[model samples]
Target chain A: MIGWKQIPPGMVILEAGSALKIKTGSWRAAYKPRWIEENCIQCLLCWLYCPDNAVKVEDGKRQDFDYEYCKGCGLCALECPGKKGNKAIVMEEEVR
Target chain B: MVTPLNLKELSKKELRFTAGHRLCAGCAAPTVVKMILLAACDYPVVVASSTGCLEVSSCISTYTAWKVPWIHSAFENAAATLSGVESMYKALKKQGKIDKEIKFIAICGDGGTYDIGLQSLSGAMERWHDMLYVCYNNEAYMNTGIQRSGATPTYADTTTCPAGSVIPGKPQPRKDLTKIMAAHGIPYVAQAAPSHWPDLMKKVRKALEIPGPKFMNIFTPCNRGWRTRTDDAILLSRLAVDTCFWPLYEVEKGVVRVTYKPKEKKPIEEFLKLQGRFRHLFEPGREQLISELQRMIDENWERLLKEEEIFASKEEEKEEVVK
Candidate 1:
């Protein structure tokens, strides 16, 4: 949680590039993406189309979603190039 | 030099706009925001957003999705605010208070840019502020219950301009905003749709590299407002460009260039049929409206080609004289 007490009144800290602290994945109340690694062609289309920077990539390969920040918009599923019924990513309901 | 051909590299670059903000599913604004931020990867970015969907959705009181420094001021003063910020940065850099290079960006919706914020945007442009003003034009004022804005296309049904027996959606055509921006004679001006990522990405890079004011009017389709499926936003944008309704073009230093021309230009109906806003226009009585819209698109496309030719010749003449 951000500490408001440490900051001055009516003044924002304007912390440069500090979005990492905010966990946004909890905002996904319904659907979440389940990546099927084997089906992925490594096209990286899902990573490019994701509105949120939730798609985690390492060393030019698709790692997985940073679920801590993914809002489960399912854009990756929509942009997945895998064949029907065998999509590299699938949008499923959150277990909770 | 992040090209659309290598947008995958963008994922490696630190994203200025992160995920988990509250933009709607398949909303195009986030794509626009991300692409612009990635385009400015060469410098530290400071963003200013007007009061619109992108601002309201992303920045709540306690949280923000923006990884870069951001400010949300008013419905019409984003450009004005950023101009001030850019001037301050310039002063601070000269005074040795700040040493690193910083780029300024102002994001506004069509309502803010084409209507309410027009004067402020024009003022900033005329002042030649060193920043980029990007209008994510979703056509109507979707933030305020789909009100008809200056950027709304002709005969499209908005809440304020509802279709009826007597009068169809907006009676007037959309204001030619990109041309208006180019008339400012700034360093760069462009009209891009997210459908063509590479073209848009290239424009963003070129615009940011330039020294003076830059403007980009991007066609952002709204799923809720357009009454289309969430996943159809990109498809809709592609159709828009294919129909030549939103031609991909740019103006740099008074020279006009058409970026992409579809091999077989799709009909306006292909673009108009998908959006529920234009559903009424397909009815039997509204056939004339379709023709009218098509005619308007054709006229604009012709004008763009003519302008490109004229400008290219002018550039050649200048080179000849210099030689």
Candidate 2:
């Protein structure tokens, strides 16, 4: 851990988004979502509905899940309306 | 003209409310905060959050999820704090001490806004501060255990008011804080849900644009407090809108407009049954309570529609409304 001396002089938080250091992914007890790239229609509904900004997007397109912060809420899978009737995201037991 | 909300453009903007915070798995506050920041991403924003699940979770001792300037204040004074900040900004701007246009937003939970901070909020709006006050109304005081709040709808079971055989749940309906805020004669006031992002975001943009006090009563779901499925936060919000329990509408300059009217209004049961807080209302003996709740919702919806009709501007007919 960094010393308090390293902190900028302020009553507010030392860093704006220093919460990024906390990995909340371990909050998942049993299940996590497995993304199927081919079925993703990219409507971006999952990204919008995600409680965590786990559904990463790059340059306006969907990217891989950011597991560091994802709590495996599976909202992305629940909200994703993929191509045809197949879902772009499916819940899977976390082997790790 | 309502410029079409492009999801792509929104996605490209830098995230202000980031992840790794300790909000619950399916907590709706994070999504709500993200949407608010995304809508006002064009302007530099300073957020003041009250002592609730949002502030404590997002801003732990040494870490913060907010990229924008953020301050955490007492439970009953977020509005007061932000309004003071806005007043200072005005004073500074007059003295040529500050130049950049900065937006002031005070975020509060239902407990803070509806119950604890109501007077502070009312006073700030009355003072005509240039700021936007957003209350993430989860219906109860979820932060300090799920206790009944002034915003808790009738018949819902909270810790303080449990739904027992004799007592049932909370006997009285929620205080209509939206109408109360609208009565303040502020420039903008709206009620929105996270499920309808486009409508919600558009309201945020509009609220920020208008100079003066703006208040948005956003009905965000609290999965932990409501005992809902972790993934059902957005779904429940959508059902709330469709069932007319939490109608999406805005009061601009005292002229009311119902933003998204359900094509076919659904029964309140659809919205109630999903949450454990309202589970006791579904029992055999409590069936009458359901109908009573239904009637109450229908009455509320009618009243809102009537308000919209009465205060509707002369330019647009009552039937042809913005969807």
Candidate 3:
């Protein structure tokens, strides 16, 4: 019957500023998908629902993602409005 | 010499759900999946995941992190799929094809468990299948960008139920899932969270040992969906339990026993203020909603204590009869 108020020290207690210190560099490249020019129709679903505003469209056609801001959240890849065979954007691993 | 049971030692050495998977930072589903696997160990387990965050992140057709036998069915059929697996295992055991005891687990999000898959889950529970059902309840359909689910807390903001001029996010309270499972007279039903790792591990072990149906609703924090810091996953779970927003308890043999109760329960605002989902609750005229939420928690806590008292009295009566 451990008392609730006495949270043990070093028990991984989560504080407000804890997230600010975590290095998110590892998560950034985990799912940054590249668009294939051959298959892309540029429906812009990826751009519209970027969540992190990672995707950008040029002249309402060519789609590009700024990987620095992209947390690799995968919303763009999932919500692509392109037809099944003609997907405008496809998830490709970030090239080292 | 005192022998210590290193619970982590009971976990499988093989890494099934490897790191670098595509789940959102601080998503609760992965923790639930990991704990279930750790509890099951190498028991020839086969998992059926619903079409939610856990399924999409772990089994995206082209990329999969699962090392064991796993299947992804529709959003509302994980229970049915696991039931089929259990039936198959039983048939195979009868014919001597498989001699060892195997475990079948169904994993789903709150949407799948409380809303869409409720019928299938109820049917499986009614049939008394030898399967463990885990609901990674992050309170919404997180994979679809935070839509409201039946398990969503009252006044929590979601895409569909946004806090706006007229409405202050979700209007209804969270569905009582543990009571629902207990109503089916299941052998075991428990509510657990990752923040309480030891308690969670103990419940998982006990649930797995039971021969009949077992349901565990695990409160997992969704950093993106809940609008909280990515690192606050464990903290959010702790706050939920401490505020009595999510009581940690287990129901065994139709008797309810609260596993943990906080002393000087923290205010609901302490829990709500951290998450963006409940930000609207702080607005003017929203104090009523907060009070309503507090009243609900108080009522539920009282009911739980009353149930424990009744259970104790019943045990005493049985003891007198035996004497």
Candidate 4:
């Protein structure tokens, strides 16, 4: 999600903790996690293991990931409980 | 009063350290970082890393793996740098220039903590900096070609102390850096491993809550340096704890508590055999080294138990006096 457009060269970040402004979704190069809400048990293991905190959940239920920040680390997919059979969240190759 | 019922609510509230770093696939440092950051998520944190693998790998030139405010300066002075940062933050907050509660975390490896950065760390802790210092001790100088360090275990092969006919490996026992830090009489000192997430997480929360300098010597296994498969890092860490190679314990106000004790303490060979660094010890005529290693582990474990008992009885006596 962190693209060249959002970041300027010369390492000039004027404000402290300003990284929140930079959408790092563009950092995912090859793959992204595709969530199947129906199959999700809402265990939230994916949320805990997600390095990017990309797995979005609301009201104690699972939601679609915020691609605006996910770096395609595949940790969520790796930890997704549905991997045994349900396949709630799968890493699909990026079309880009 | 509110409590997180499950992992989902917990993540929503505090996900400080986001993933996607260049740390090796199975290395324990990233996990350790994640757990520690999550534990300290209640406060805004400024994390600083010494010139080590975690720094170089995570902060690659322009691209940074850190989601929060982070700084990387030199190999030996992360504590000093963060001390300055904490001092400045305190000053700014007092002057009304800054208004948020910020916690400081200094991260380093064994090379930095047990050797190069000892003076800086001691000075910072002695001066009573309101910071948490974490040493991801992988035993050797893992960032610099796996050279032996002050924290290296005896009879382990390293670049500087390679196993050969002349010498088996490193000649000396590791310095008890945790006890040394405890000697400073800071609020908290602990030894933890990534394999025990709940224990490590608890310690992190406790450390950050304490009002002064706190230190955690975490066993971060290095797949590359230990010459083990990348996926075996966590397994090795668990073995390290079970075999008493890295005891799980904490010291608070001079009170020693052994956090985890294996039901059947696995022999040190169970741990050493997993790594190629100790492969030479299993060779012909070198079986003696294995027993020696076991003897050392047994002695240390016994000493730790005695210390804990002495402190526990002392506390009981104090309570009796109060009654």
Candidate 5:
């Protein structure tokens, strides 16, 4: 698993450093896409469209996203075609 | 007429554009941009915009509503070009060439923010430049005739993601760009809809106050794209927030707080049903998409609550130590 320390500088890292601050308060939030393996067709669309190379593949199949630098833009879910009977990719909210 | 109580009240009365700007009747972008300018009235603002509906309508070379300094760049490079303008401003400030405090703002559509301009947006935000980036998200690329964009909601029918015999409309959900901006660790990031004028104004003021990069993603409705009534833009914005589809909140210094939480959250269908883009989702088998959308909202609300609890507890601990 890639940790916060593993993120390289100049890269867009999700859930790293301080939470986004506004005038009202801070938000310790992270955007991560959940993969439902049962629904995945091994289409590899999620891996192909991820802007930050956050998704990984194993044995020529889709794997989990490496959140270390995943900006959680939800492009993977947007691009994933395995969303018919069961949505293979879903955007989830995580509190840091 | 009686004099106004504040500058804001007075500025509203003296708009440069009378009423005949080329923007569609229900377009929320023009109003949001006006609000931003009103809030940042303290500084000399230079606006760099992308080739979207807003730019196309306001800037026709010979005639324009942009009274302040402005430039219309390509669809994908407003952020990058604005970064250059900001750098030049800084150098000029140090050399005493430009002594005034000038604010730089980059305005773009969803196509620019989530698709073509994503790289430039990242570059500008990463550089920690003193600027405010506003994404006037109308959900699709309306300037190009209602094409699908990364910001379009799930299951919504667009020209690109149209429902066909083999496939339903846009099968995937909208991109969570707010979370993406927050991950950059910028000083300010928030989502505002023009329907909530007070909230949008407050966030704009806060973003201007921040010394580092600030990003505000505003949900502007498009009558042309969504196939809605021309006068329903404000109503649509209000419904979006009231239904919990678009929560009104802000994140400050790593603490997440809800600015406005509905006492009784309305059904998501109320907001979805108004727009024709989501018409297909109301059909059979597509019911699952609605449930999934609800689940996503619920998940986000739960996470927001947990964040508040953690931060509140930490504050309580600090208070106990003080005692």
Candidate 6:
């Protein structure tokens, strides 16, 4: 730990976006959302609603989850308005 | 009408509010933050957040969830914090010290916004600061363990005002914060929900472009405080809008505009039943409470529509006079 005098000006961490290094995906103790690519209509609601920004999207189309930071809130699966019984994203138990 | 919002193109913008930090699972605050940042993506941004969940969780010591410049403010002075920053920016720009355009935002949960920071907010708005004040209204003080706040809806059970056999939940109606901000007669005041991203983005964009104080009361559901499933924040937000419990509307220059009108307005039960905070309201003999809450919502909705009809034509008249 740095001394008070050694701390950056206003204690502001000079490095921007430093939180990306913290692997918050460990917070997901149980369920992890599985993105079934074929079922995705690419509405981007999952992308929009992910609290962690874990849903990886490119060019408006659905891609995969950045599990390193996902936190496995299962929000993507819960809000996916896919065809009945064949939702785009579904929660699976983390086999730890 | 404002230009069409292209979601596909917008999806490609750099994520200003990045991953990691300690916000609770299914926390709607991050989604709200992301939406606001995305809307203001075209410019460099500086955010001042009051001492609340977003501040406590997202920016802990050396780690920060924000990619852009960020400042943490006191519980009752986020508006003041941003106000000072904006004034400095203006001064520096005039002296040619800063060359780029930067957007300013003050964020707070309902705890700070509807109660603690209200005075500062009013003062800043009255002073016409070139900043946007966004309140992510989860309806209670969730970070402090779901205590009842001024924004907590009528009779919704909270830790401070827990429902029991003797007395049911919170005694007072939820404060109409958006309406109060509108009464300030600022350039823009809006009540949006994170569920409707397009409407929210549009409002944020419009608010930033207008060179005066703007306020947005965004309905962000708390999965923990509301005793909901971890994933229900977005849907609960949607239900809040559909039931008129939290209307999606904006008051631009004192003229009200309801953003999205549900083809069939859902009943308050649909919204209340989804959350455990309102579980007591549905119990036997508590039917009166439900009806009373419904009546309150209906009255507010009617008043908003009436205001829209009255002032909408007047807005057109102002435009005509300008032409």
Q: For model 6, what is the alpha-carbon lDDT of residue B242?
A: 92
Candidate 6: share of reference interface contacts reproduced = 0.79
Q: Once model 5 is optimally superposed onto the true structure by TM-score, how far is the C-alpha of residue B180 displaced, in angstroms?
A: 0.8
Error of 2 at B144 (Å): 1.3
Docking class of 5: incorrect
Cα distance off (Å), candidate 1, residue B91: 1.2
Q: TM-score, chain A, per candidate?
A: 0.81, 0.86, 0.57, 0.76, 0.64, 0.88
Q: Report the candidate with higher DockQ, 2 versus 5.
A: 2
Return whichever of 2 and 6 wins on DockQ.
6
From the highest lDDT down, the ranking of the candidates is 2, 6, 1, 4, 3, 5
Question: TM-score of the B chain in model 5?
Answer: 0.92
* Residues B92-165 of candidate 2: C-alpha lDDT, one tens digit per residue: 99999999999999989988999889899999999999999999999998888999999999988989999897
Docking level of model 2? medium
Error of 3 at B267 (Å): 1.3
In angstroms, the error of model 5 at B60 is 1.5
Per-residue lDDT of model 4, residues B260-303, tens digit only: 99999998888988899999999999999999999999999999
* Candidate 3 vs candidate 6, TM-score winner: 6
What TM-score would you give candidate 4 relative to the actual structure?
Answer: 0.82
Model 1 chain A lowest lDDT segment of ten: A11-20
Candidate 6 docking classification: medium
**What is each candidate's fraction of native interface contacts (fnat)?**
0.36, 0.79, 0.00, 0.15, 0.00, 0.79
State the lDDT of candidate 5 residue by residue for A1-96, as single tens digits. Answer: 346577556333233112111111111145567888888887664543343335666545567866654555455565466847667988778766
lDDT of 1 by residue, B71-168 (tens): 87899899999999999999999999999878888989999999999999999999999998999999989987899999999998999989998779
iRMS values in order, in angstroms?
2.6, 1.2, 18.0, 5.0, 20.4, 1.0
Cα misplacement distance, residue B81 of candidate 1 (Å): 0.9
lDDT of 4 by residue, A1-96 (tens): 456677666553434423444466777778888998778888876665454556777766778998877767565665566845887988789988
The stretch of ten residues in a row with the least summed lDDT in candidate 5 chain B is B12-21
Quote the lDDT for A29 in model 4.
74
How do these models rank on DockQ, best leading?
Answer: 6, 2, 1, 4, 3, 5
Interface DockQ of each model: 0.42, 0.78, 0.02, 0.19, 0.01, 0.79
* Winner of 3 and 6 under lDDT: 6
- Lowest lDDT sum, 10 consecutive residues, model 4 chain A, at A12-21
TM-score-best of 1 and 6: 6
